[model samples]
Target chain A: MQNNWEKLNQELFTSSKRVIILSHRSPDGDSVGSSFGLYHFLKKFNHHVQVITPDPVPPFIHWIPEFETAINYEKQKDESFDAIRAADIIFCLDFNTPSRMGNMEFAFDRRSKDAYVINIDHHQQPDNFAHFQISDTSASSTAQLIFDFIIKTKGKTALDAQIAQCLYAGILTDTGSFRFSSTSPHTHRVVADLLETGIDVNAIYQKIYDNYSQDRIKLLGFALKDKLKLYPEYHTAIIDLSEKELNSFQFQKGDTEGIVNFPLSISWVKMSVLLTQKDGIVKMSFRSKGNFSVNELARNHFNGGGHENASGGMSTLSMQETLKQLESILPDYKQKLDESKI
Target chain B: MQNNWEKLNQELFTSSKRVIILSHRSPDGDSVGSSFGLYHFLKKFNHHVQVITPDPVPPFIHWIPEFETAINYEKQKDESFDAIRAADIIFCLDFNTPSRMGNMEFAFDRRSKDAYVINIDHHQQPDNFAHFQISDTSASSTAQLIFDFIIKTKGKTALDAQIAQCLYAGILTDTGSFRFSSTSPHTHRVVADLLETGIDVNAIYQKIYDNYSQDRIKLLGFALKDKLKLYPEYHTAIIDLSEKELNSFQFQKGDTEGIVNFPLSISWVKMSVLLTQKDGIVKMSFRSKGNFSVNELARNHFNGGGHENASGGMSTLSMQETLKQLESILPDYKQKLDESKI
Candidate 1:
């Protein structure tokens, strides 16, 4: 299996140039991270490499290597889409389908006619547009596959501080600093490999995880104090932020990033949601514990599907209307939770 | 040194009936942690144990084992002082002189006249009040000494989950999760031993460090956004909070905890200060990098002394006056920082 992966990687690298790596919309730590990690790897081999995302990198994502280089097509009106059109190979990472790319789907489709699209992702299934799809759902992050690629195909000596830092960021954020259930001994081995780079792990941790703006923290405080809504019997938690409240707090693009995770801390709360108004659309994030599949719930009810533990969607309806829909379905989830004794 | 400490601890444990374990005034993570660690240890031996503090346990100190049981003499008006007066042993941990005990000095002096006072602390210098003093300034925390006592005297087999949790808290906070300069191989060994008890390491980390109330975070936001005052040329950062702001934010004891460390991230800043109003006393905390000794700076300038990197003190002047003083002395420290080229 390992030899086959190396052969495939070698073939892909040899035959391709002007490689573009892409991740999902609203790129998170994993998607942005894995995409950038691959971007750097291709750059090392003198390939004309670029990483493009649908949305701007979030503030928390700023700590990752070469984040400033990630061009958001929406922001760069002058960006030559010619790079994508001229590319020989386009690598799509951390996502399965073109629709998951949001507005980037058009560019991806247009470029695929000229270039062989290689899907190197850690998600279920693959888009039919890809000629070579290396989708491993069992892998925690696409970066992990890239790490194996660097070691097995390239060489362990190829792993530099920059690459190690990028990989570490992906592994650390995705595993919640090795606290999440997804973490395994393989994750520790990856971390141990990164630590061998002598990257001053403490400073990196302080910079990435510990550092936070007082205003963002205050915004969180205000949400919890006045806006948090909890349904104890239903074991559900909800937090809402209107555009006016966000504006008043001078909210940055990524200010509400991890607010959804806070609610799940309540021992009884099996699921959590954070509803916010962004660009005139009501954005809702769903998170769950145990076997409660937020992706299934969001995809079936709202127009969204993600991992089993987390999912997100946008609604044309007002938050009030969304709450009514949620209220109707919450009782069924509560019953399921009770039956599972969670 | 080992034989003497072991003999003293053994004698105290065997003869003492009602023992009082006292931490420092304005108890912090290490002080309260060591106090509670020893409290739980003595309780396991079926000794009558009462943990005492001069003031209330600071909010950040809740990570200590059985911290809820710590008695605040300042808050308890109805409780008899006679209970302390009749104790066979008084174990003073994490403090040296009675002057540092604040209001508890009167009670401590009265109780120790007939009792065996064993001072088990991790501080510089000592007074002649105690019959036995195990004050090793080299130790990261008194809990480190307590762990040593447990291994050499109580035996390694005596360690259990609760005791391990307490000891882990002490070592973790004092060493900044094994990132600080004081962190040694012995600290790692202590952590390894704690893990042997099957205590969930991640759970303890989440409970202590990850547990953040939104309100406190908001207060932090307000401080950074509005309260931050910096001498950019001096590479000195200061955040001064007024009593009115504290009251409006509903500031508790630990509201500004770890707030001082944020400013040091800016590459230019060599030192930082967090000044807040506590009972009208200008409470100032200092943090520094490299060889800049905040302990000496705090002691000489602000009536505070602590480790080389971190320290605190109280000022008789108002918060505004204190800020003024800090600004006046800025140029000297600025020159020092420049000389260090840090």
Candidate 2:
């Protein structure tokens, strides 16, 4: 499996002159980290490398080295499109499908005819968009895959503190700080190698987890106290937020990002769901422990699908109606939830 | 240093019959991790090893392997006393001074005449209590020292997953996940070695961080919203919680463990202070960024001292009076605080 990736990477880079790296929309730690990790690694070669994000990198991840250099397609459409047009090889990182690119999907599709597209991701069921596809669902994060890519192609000597810090942040956030089930011993070994590069793990943790606004934490408090709901019989928990409640806290794009996972902390909760009303649609996020399979639930009920333990969905109905839709279907999974307990 | 420690460890273990490991009162991650790491390492030899704590382990840290076996002096006094009395070798794992052992200090002192006490700690200015002292302030945690101790004596092949998990937890928590200044390149190297043991780093992190109660998070919200005070001129942030507020939240012993470190997340804040009134005395915690010395502030003004960035202090004055005291000294340290910023 690694030999194939190594051959493809070598063949693609040997003759390639200009390279543009792109991550999915609403760039997260993994997206930003993997893009920059590849960008920094490829910079050591005799080629020009550029990183472009679908949108601006979030403030929490702003401390990453050279993060400001990543061109935001949302803000600078002309420059991002120019880079996409002129690229010889384009690296699509962290996302599986072109539709996940949001507004950049058109540009990617238009330029794919001329550029050699390389899809590198950990998500399941990647689309057949790239000429060379390196996808592994078992990998903890895309950054981990990138680490293996670097080691396979350039060897361990190519790793430096800057690359290590970026990859570490990616793995740390995607594995939920090494707590997620996707994390394997190989993931830890990869992290160990990254640490050897003199990256400060704690500073990266602070930059990712602790750089939140005061109002966001306060919103978390309100969500837990006033919004959280528990269904012990079904081994499930839920937090539903209306547009007004979010506005009161002045909700930003990523304010409620990980709030859904908080309920999964309870010992008995096998599944959790978060429903937020925004932009005339009720956005839904589902998370589960063990083998409850939130992906199936999200796909069947709410027009979205992701990994087994975590998934996303959306509803065109009102917040009340969407919650009613959720309550209606939870009982069907009672047996599954009970069996998920280890 | 390695040779001396190896000799001391070999001499101490070879002739010893019963080994008892003791950590300081109000045991934390470092305390529990170091004690248990040593306990598991020594159990491999032809000797009986036991671990004891001055009080109950916090609920957040109770998921560690064999955690329930550690005798708590506060709850099981007779068993702890008997263990101390019968032991021929006592390992002082985390604390520097015997006074830090709380009520168990008497038993330690009484048994010191017959048993050989080996102190392995990573604190500044260790007391002259142990016959064989292995103290390095540069080490991230006592657990890190124990990792070195194992490598020095038995070689790296002797390390297993259980010991690695315990020591990794120790290093992870002590360095605040590797953000603290005490975290050096050597710390990362030690963690790398531990990770090579195939321990589940994510599971350990989940067990430690995601086990907090609902009230504790709510209390944090209240502390940030109602009690937090910012002195922008002095680059100081304070959280003053009265007894009533704590009672309303039904504060547990370790509820406020990391609350003081929250204000330091602000880009401009250089110093953070948490004052919580309990019984008659007001307990205080001081945290600073960069070169600011909280130890000096704690030692000179509040009758307490710890590491440079983190320190503890106490006051006999009323909560109102303590606020006045803090306010009065704000101007005196303006020059120092200004110069401390990196």
Candidate 3:
């Protein structure tokens, strides 16, 4: 990517610069991971680097090294503005356009005219918004891309345990712990290289994925115990949670994020659906394992569309009515669902 | 491991031999995956290979290539015996000693003379029974060992999707989907190489891991809902099921096998225990992550022991009493348990 390595190295990486490492708003594992992984690597090059985020790092990601030091534009506007004013180079990671920064876009627009922005992302179709970009939609995560960047620039010797753990966290979460189709052979190889740095893979996995709230776990238990209904013949499962029941568990916004995918662990379940009712509307989350496209199901029925395996929909009907409608529609897709899991 | 490559090539691998691939009793993912992976590889050399298990490859393993073709020593004694007798080279896989064959030890004992046995396993303290042995307890799984073996002998070109899937299944299961500490960097590298063969990793993962019975899932729900108790201060959780509760779920032996490990998924939980009262006694399963040693705990208090992370015990006390005792003992170990998960 560096056609003029000497010039870019001298200007961007060689000499000490006030580099601001920036990620998308509402930062996730990949964004935080890629940002700090690059941040740590840059620190080795004697760069005065400061990682900045649009929001605070969630508790699940607090285990990452120096995560608290990352300047939050929303939380510390004056400091973030000061950091932006002092920056010589800015890194746009895990997101394409500056619009992905949401309310933090103003912070980016305030960067000095001389500030050089290098984009590193895996999301498809980046906006024409950076001085240099390394975009590969095929990459499992931006963390993996950042790994390649470090190896290409400074070679494998530059990676240390801290950088490895951050990257490992990124790839592990984004790739669904190496279970998703996005996890390519190179992803595993990158993980192998990362593991060789003496990062505890098990610990990284635990820190990223295992930080569940007690109430959230209890809600999961209740959902599985009382609401889950399985249809063996149709190879389908549905779990419906009412607003009342959710309140009983003190449900928050993201409590049901993964509940729909859980039933996919059942061998016969080709398609799993979770319907959560709040504010008189039922929201549906669909997850399929093998070949059944929840995207198609969501588009053809409900006014929603997303990925092939995971999709979302909404119904104005009651949860019971929604379940009834879904059950009635199952027989039509039974043939595909029967073949989906195999 | 092959000191005399030329000799081994001529005598063991190059020439067509009636190759009998044998694994230990009660075939698991590692045993079946290793045996059949080697089975497919040996076929390239024109060796007529018959994979034999001590019993039927369980329903869970039916997805592996030629798993059904694997002669079951228990179900088809004559076929197994005949295969053993006709063998010119016996590949002992996934087991250290012949005694692990259980009742099928006779089958091994009856093998024809001049049948050179090469033992390939990862288990510790392999018996001095085979002419050649590659036992590395450090290997994550026999599947990983087999991958190394394949690469050593035939080079990367020898691996195909079938062989890759088989070995992938072995490593995936043995390493607990790459979460267990046994999963080394080399293990991930081996998987990377396997994935290079264009195997459908997602499908393989689904086939091997998603095959759960409906009753088993329901039982898991019941346990989590009605039996589980959490001690956040001690970083511990426990689930206990009485005989009546077990009966209500139509309990099977392995239904509760991994129940103790579930609580460890919560980030703060260092130790998790499952106490199931069946027949006349309460059986205890203890699992802890990070530094805590459940083996010592089990051995000290419950007269049982196993590995550092997972162990077992038995109690004459009622489920309630066992829970009380465990809760009381946890306070004494709170300091360690608090530090255990990190």
Q: Which candidate ranks first by TM-score, i.e. highest?
A: 2
Q: What are the RMSDs of all candidates, in order?
A: 7.0, 3.2, 3.5
Candidate number that wins on DockQ, 2 or 3:
3
Write the residue-wise lDDT of candidate 1 on B233-326 in tens digits. 8777788888888888777766677788867755556788898887888888898866688888898888889878789888999887888888
- Best by the DockQ measure: 3
lDDT of 2 by residue, A46-149 (tens): 67888988887888888888887888899999998988988888999999999998999877877846687888999988878787878999999999999999
Docking class of 1: incorrect
The 10-residue segment of model 1 chain B with minimum total lDDT is B178-187
Candidate 2 lDDT tens digits, B1-342: 223555566655676479999999989999998888888888888668889999888877776778878889999888889889888889998888999999999888778467878899988888888878888988889999999989978999879988988898898888776667577767767876887787766567767776656677667767776677888899898999888889898888878888898788766678999999999789999998778999999999999998788899999999999999999999999999998853
Give TM-score values for chain A, per-prediction. 0.90, 0.93, 0.85
Per-model DockQ against the true two-chain complex = 0.09, 0.32, 0.62
Residue-level lDDT tens digits of model 3 in B314-335: 9998878888888889878988
Enumerate residue pairs that collide in model 2.
A178-B202, A179-B202, A202-B178, A202-B179
lDDT score, candidate 3: 0.85
* Most lDDT-accurate candidate: 3
